[model samples]
Target chain A: MLRLILKDILIQKKTLLTAFIYGFFAIYVFGVKYYTNGGFVAGAVAIGYLFITYAVSYDDKNNCHIALNSLPVKRIEVVLAKYLSVVLFGCIGIFTMIIDGFLAELFGFAMPKNYVAINNVLMVFGVLLVMYSIYYPLYFRFGAVKMNIVNVFLFMTIIVLPKALGEFILNHENNPLIKEVLNFIRNSPKSVIQILSFAAVALISLISIGTSTRIYKSKDF
Target chain B: MSNILEIRNLRKQYDKFSLKDISFSLERGYIMGFIGPNGAGKSTTIKLIMNLIKRDSGEIKVFGLDNIKNEKEIKEKIGFVYDENYFYEHLSILEMKRIIAPFYKHWDDGTFKKYIKDFNLPPSRKIKDLSKGMKMKFSLALALSHRAELIIMDEPTSGLDPVFRIEMLEILQSLIQDERVSVFFSTHITTDLEKIADYITFINDGSIVFSRPKDDILESFALIKGGKELLDKDTRKEFLAIKENSFGFEALTDNTDRIKKIFKNEVIIERPTLEDIMVYTVRGEIKCLDSY
Candidate 1:
């Protein structure tokens, strides 16, 4: 399973190069203007999931899933390798950004003013886990062609959902439940939310892994 | 002979094409040629045997164990080559092999190096840089290096010119000389199999037309050519397929003695090639009243 994960990363190393480009671009942007810790981290983190999506495209192009399955590995292992690889890429992405930040400072570029917050990093990771949890099952089921269409819809939804929810919460400002929810958000410790969010993402990711393995097992080459 | 692979009542259904109940067994020390025309469920059956595709209903046993239940063990002992190459095109041959080698407990570095030398495959060449035939050699090198007991190939020689095709067939023939290995290969190119296969399992549409020894098929199956007057509704029933025209009519039959007895000296009864069986089985029946 570890080997399979490594294979996915190694095969898609060419695409992973773009994440460096994105990091350099982020460094350039931070140098010129206002860059918060959150903003710098977000720029770095966005490209982490691209590793996974790109690997899917690589597998689709080369028909590697069939080749991999033909070997002495379980279908579930291949599915799990995909889920685990996102975390690996996530670590690599964040580490690259840290290195890039130090280099930018050394080269006489302005650095983000704020320190990296543990709570914010956890939140970002939580969101990534949730997105990947949902994304994989869809990719496993419909594959790259149909999933490409779904990705656009998903991107639109991601952009629109927060605004729609914000409007709903404001519109219901007078409601006792809405006020209680706002109170919880205001009063709860950030760590508590982060831990709870991580738990939820873990649960969702487990469910998605199960779903993907089932879909992949029955998939025809 | 101990059976290395056995499949029974295998079936997979798609909206357009389906594999009917397919049953064939390969002995431990010989090759089985899986022959069918395009869209004849040959590759589908191979995929089912590999468990790369799920079968709707059937049983496949490799080395006397249930294929799905013991997939890892079965696959560890089996080497597979596909019609198309499936590798990280950017990875050098050594890197690609490094990724695959850890999976098989029996993988031999020495055997791999020997094959690389024998096939003249450069260790540093990326897979995409190689020609199709060279890519196939690379795949075969990987397949053979693990000391696998069974080699299952899907159209392993489809695109190769005659030279490479013969070379590949000869390589496969040499593998079986150890008497511990078996080969099951599917192809539309019948000549490759004609030169190497011990048994032939012919598929048409979605079902097995015949699964017998190659010599039996070569000897018994025949083509009958006769005047157009000799071919009619009653006579046509004797042959599996018939192509009729004004100049003459040719038909294919598996029962040569029966066909010869029925037709006597009135028609020409000749040996049928594997290609003839495939063509006639796929085409089944054709009509040509005019000689254009």
Candidate 2:
């Protein structure tokens, strides 16, 4: 499983370098200038997504699945390796964000507000888990080529979802159910929310991995 | 476990094509030439043996263990070469090797290095930089480096030039000299098998035409040339397929002794090559209808 994940990362070494420079640029111009912590969240998500998707496209481009399956590795290992790769890239994304933060400070640029806050980290991890949880089963079923349109739709949903939710809350501010839900959230403990959020992400990821393994095991090369 | 690879009544169904219940086996320390025309279920069978595709119904055993139940263990000892280059094109050969080498339990870096040098493959060069022949050599080098007991090659010589094909054949020949490794080589190119294959398994239209020792196959099948008048409906049944022209009739038959007994030297019986057997049998039923 480690080798498989390493293979994905090694093949994208050039892309990773370019992404580092690009991440710094984004955090500098768009990150610091725009919505403060949102910039970091957006940058990390974009880089993580780009890395995993590019690795998948590389496999599709070269039909490496056939080669990989012919080796001693199990089908479940391949599926797990892909899920693990998202985590690896997410860590790399966060690590790069720290380096970018330092680089910005060295150049005398103001750092984004609350860039490394625990909430931001949790949000980034949650968003990645949700995105991959939805994306991977479909990928394992339809493959990279057939999932192009679906991928765009999924990415668009991720970009538009927060704004849509905010608008819904504003539009329904007078509604009793909405007010009650907002009050409950306002009264809930921070640790409880964190535990619930972590549980939800873990549950979604487990289901996704199960679905992907089932789809991949019965697949023909 | 004399048989290193075995498939019994294996089947796979696609939209337009299906591999009907096909069965064949290869013993240890011998090369079995899997010869068939295009779309003849050659690759499908190999894929089934490798468990790359799920078999509809049947049993496939490799190294005397169930293929699916023991897939990872079975694959640890099986090296495969497909017709196309499936390695990451952007990565160098060394990088590709690094990724694949850890999967096999018996992966030998020294053996891999020796092949890289012998095949003249630049370790640092990207896979896409290699030519077709070079890419195939790179694939063979990888397949061979792990001390695989059964080497399954699916049309490894299809697009290669004659010289390189011969070179590949020589490598297979030399590998079997130790009498511990067996090769199951699939190709429509029958001549390569003629030189190195110990047994031949022929499939056509998703069905097995024959699978037997190469010499037995050659000895059993005969190409007979005779006047068209001799090919009546009764005598034609003896031939698997027949071709008739204005001058004479040339037919392929497995029953050479029966033909000799019936024709009484009136027909010319000659030894048939593997190509003759494959072509005649594949195109058999459709060729000689008008001659009747």
Q: Which candidate number maximizes lDDT?
A: 2
In order, what DockQ does each candidate have?
0.68, 0.86
Clashing pairs in 2: none
For TM-score, the strongest prediction is: 2
Docking class of 2: high
Instruction: Encode model 1's per-residue lDDT on B140-194: one tens digit a residue.
Output: 9999999999999999988888987888888889999999999999998898887
The ten-residue window of minimal lDDT in model 1 chain B covers B283-292
Compared with the true structure, what per-residue lDDT tens digits does model 2 show for residues A1-221?
89899988988888778778877876866577874777677778777888888999999988899999999989999999999988888888877877888888799888866778878777878898899999999999998999888887887798679989999999999999999988987899988878988999999999999999999999999
Q: What lDDT does candidate 1 reach at residue B52?
A: 84
Using all chains and alpha carbons, the TM-scores for the candidates as numbered come to: 0.89, 0.96
Q: Name the top DockQ candidate.
A: 2
Runs in model 2 with CA error above 4 Å? B287-292
